[model samples]
Target: MLRIRPRALPVPATVLAWPVAVGSLALAVAALVLHASTVGGLRDTTNLHLADLWLSVLGPTVGAAVVARDRRTGLVLLGTAPIAVGAVAGAYAVWSAEVGGAPGAAAAAWLATWTWVPFFLPALLLPVVLRSGAAARLGAPVAGVLVLIAVFSAFAPGPAGPFAAVPNPLGLAWAPWLGPAAGVLIGLTAVVLVPAAALLAVVRWRRASGDDRWQLGLLAAGEAVFVAAHLSPVTAQPLSDVLVAVGLTALLGSVALGVHLRSVTAGLRRERELLATARETERLRLHRDLHDGVGPELAGLALQLGAVASRTGEPVLRELEGRLREVVGEVRRVVDDLRPAGLDASGLAGALRERARAFSAGDLTCAVEADVPDGLPPAVEVAAFRIAAEALTNAARHAGASTCTVRLGTEPGSLLVEVADDGSGIRADAGPGVGLASMRRRAEELGGTLRVGAGPGGGTVVRAVLPVPR
Candidate 1:
């Protein structure tokens, strides 16, 4: 059994990011209402704000705690625990921030910052951190979600309420540091976010297996260039945020495609291997059938023919030799039927001739006509030969036919094989025997149909029509 270690994570680190972000927003809203309102609301707002801060700080700290625990305690203990790193990180981010400023503005700013941390970190490190462990699996989706949140917030209106910057009504502007300060704050936030993401990603990459590391490395490197351009001076912040959203979506799409392609390729390879094995098994089975069934039977016929030759004065000896020769030939023909070997060189006509020679016995006049052209497909040749042989044998044995005629001629866009016998007429509703049923199966296998009905002169005629190969 393959022991897949539960990815190392802190207790309570498994809270999904969306819930964390939503809960943080809810806390901010509650705190803002209390802070902005009268006496009764103020106390409640302070408590909520404090709770938010506690959560944010404790979240990531627990992750480090778990890592420490893993370092000291053992991976086995961690396996028994349900703690996950992402949940902890999300919880930590949710609870850490101070909820002190204006309601709307402070909430937007905090959400933006919190979301940015995971976004930038994962974007920067997911590719690099795909080592041999749990981190690799967690990196891409975590980072992607963070980027998505940031993109959503970028288009939202600026922070309002208590957190809003003081508005200037006069002609002269008062605050010089305000504009540049905001820009610097945004830039610094981005920088800080990148490294934190890298920590998680690098840990993951180190723990990953085989080509997984290479795949993450390639994906992460491309993401880096894209992130740099988004955070750069050349683009609008809003547009850059959108671009990040698009990039993350594309990265996720690529991961999905990669997984799908890998599965499909694996399936195709397995099928091909199975097919080769099947062919080998069939070859072995055919060799055994021919050797066990046909080989001894023909040897017995040869012995009988030798005995007949020794009994010189008897008239029955000549007939016995002829019959034994036919039996030996029939055994060889049945053995050859195991697989179609040389339809290309001998053609359908030659195969039929061999079959006729095989079944020639007393009162069975077998005539085979080979007017049909050579170079017809191998499938057609094999189908034609089997159908003709089956029809001839059925006529000679069951129909008590004195004469059998096999005609092969090419019709317009079709190849026709007609076998007619001059013997007792078939009943109007005669159910097909095993030999005729086999001929029908052979014809159908090659995209053709076989028919057995009354001949004009009180006999049975079997006809098969097959398509000309393209």
Candidate 2:
């Protein structure tokens, strides 16, 4: 089994992040203030911009920086900020032509024409990146798609409302295909991208547990709000942007809480791994000390006592010698219990063969067919060997079996172990026994599975598939 090291993510410095956060907030606030002062403070325009741009764009940007587990995550959260802010501030420039920032307002107006893409696209992506593992990796590509949508919309032939009044400085009137392509992208967003993201969120939510589950739920709700505001004709009403802001706030809060929760979960997992390692190391130390030091010492003392007893003809020394021999036997048992070495030194195949031999005696015979290569990871080897051993033990002890077979093999990314005995089969309704539960735990800990049932030939069979690290 091979361990693949995680690729290190690029982390932006505090200095760089601070500038972006400040600049984004400044632009959003300036737009809101300009819109408010020019259009009346009591009007819908000012209030709508306040809820939409501030929360959807600026709010998540700042929240991610402050609460994200990594700066890279914050970067992802803020990646689409410029586009969203541009669309808002640009619209302000177009509306209030005398608003002083009109010299560059054309581009913002062109951006404003497509109301939904800039803000809603990012919202659609929140759930994917927030999941924080393989999903977090999706942040870049999705952000790339967002960029493409924005860039292509610049040349969209029949631009949205704002584009007709104000020329797109970047618009290409000759490129008719660009409009259709952008439309296709939008179509894809509606048909494929949006549905996929939603499906991914649903799947993750179903699989998630505890706090993570609810965090995803909040995220899903937030995403839904943006989609609602974008698609609905009532988007011009203050309520739309207000709900959008509330949704963005939910998104921001859920992201922070999810990152913190996942971090806690990761920390707890590491602690558990450390504890297991410590316990294993201590057991090995105890095993070695007892086997090498105490066992021989007790045996030597017993021999000396026996000699003394014979030389002096003393019954007391003889009894003491016998007691020492018994103590040595108990020590050997303790040493054996302290550690398992068969699968540790050599590979699982050999260990399993030896185990089968040990269990093969009297009325029963055991056979092994193993196709495993050497140097399987200790965890995989241990799990496979232990499961096979337990299954064989159960068969030999419980089942009146004449013969048993042990099979060890590998499937694409997993190690397979199967033990079958031709004896009275297990009851269909029988619940898991202590041994079965233990085997299941061992397999599950490695993200694997175990199944016990009637063998194809007769009697019972136990099968476990343990994932081998690759």
Candidate 3:
């Protein structure tokens, strides 16, 4: 399997990220301000530290957003660039600490939770969702629900009923073992969750797609409800042990459904994508066959007929030669109609100029103006070239065009290519010609656009604009 390189964030996103960081920093500062001015300072109550810790937790999400951005933009080729997973984990740890700016129990817990996201995000969610079929798509929502559940469980308002915690840790019956044990339990849950999710994702990706979307949804819904029950305001008991059992059962059921559906969907989507690709490949092959085999055979037969007409020197020779010439010309036209490999080989300018020159030698004129830098990304180059070729081809073959001008250059932060022809005006609704359709597809696939309309002095003009390299 090919590994995809994640991209860098866009300019707007890069700018946005710093503000999020600054906003988080401001929150910490506000915590400090509130801490000092209120009833007591940092030494008096742990709430200030807790506030700061929560603010610090926001930092890793920013970092996670950055990681997500990298994946979105195709900049994360680091999968092959010798970067170790531990290094990524360490970086997140350091970033979390720096963002925290101080150490406390709450800060530690926040840092630990925030840091867990990156590892689990890619290792767990990415594998299952991206690689899985329909289940993977549903996996995103499921994962979101789970995270929400966890957050709700962690921060749910304490002690609706009598069994809730005492105000201070010192006087509580189980404070000594309970606090540490709860922390340990959370950590252990994370350890188990990460590996289990990852393992399930891997299995699903490797499996076939007969998975049920509804079952997955039901399981997710059930877990959400189960988790909600414990965290609900109406819970009769403050520390209901029964609630824990119900939540765990729901969690176990959800996981089982997730594992099964994930495998099936992954298999299904993979097969469907493969089939689509294969179909496209077959279509291309058929096009090649018609162009290479049938078209040439027709032309060869026309040549043979022309030879017979000449050798006989009959009165019908001129008529025969004319008919054969027309046949050969039409054969050539059909071949050209079938494919435009010239555009692929020589760039758009060369192909357009060749078409223009072939169409008109004296009364018609054609020129190519190109200022493209060397080594433009191949996809961009191909798209630009094809648009130019299509415009010129349409003009010469259909529009009775006399003059054509093609230009390729950079405009602002975009690559712009335009082809204009002085010919009969084009249709308002361009017909679905293969040439036109191919040009549009090429443009769109590269995050660019194509426009064709009337030229100022009658005829048609085509333009393509694409993003410049970041």
Model 3 lDDT tens row, 40-111: 222232222231233143333333343333332111111111112122222333333334443342323332
Report the number of backbone clashes for model 3.
11
Highest lDDT against the true fold, candidate: 2
Candidate 3 to truth, TM: 0.33
Clashing pairs in 2: none
RMSD of each: 21.2, 7.0, 17.6
Query: How does residue 226 of candidate 1 score in lDDT?
Result: 44
Over 142-175, each residue of candidate 1 has an lDDT whose tens digit, in order, gives 4454445444333333331112331212112344
True lDDT of residue 271, candidate 1: 64
Better of 1 and 3 by TM-score: 3
How does each model score on TM-score? 0.30, 0.72, 0.33
Candidate 1, poorest ten consecutive residues by summed lDDT? 72-81
**Best-to-worst ranking by lDDT:** 2, 1, 3
Clashes of each: 31, 0, 11
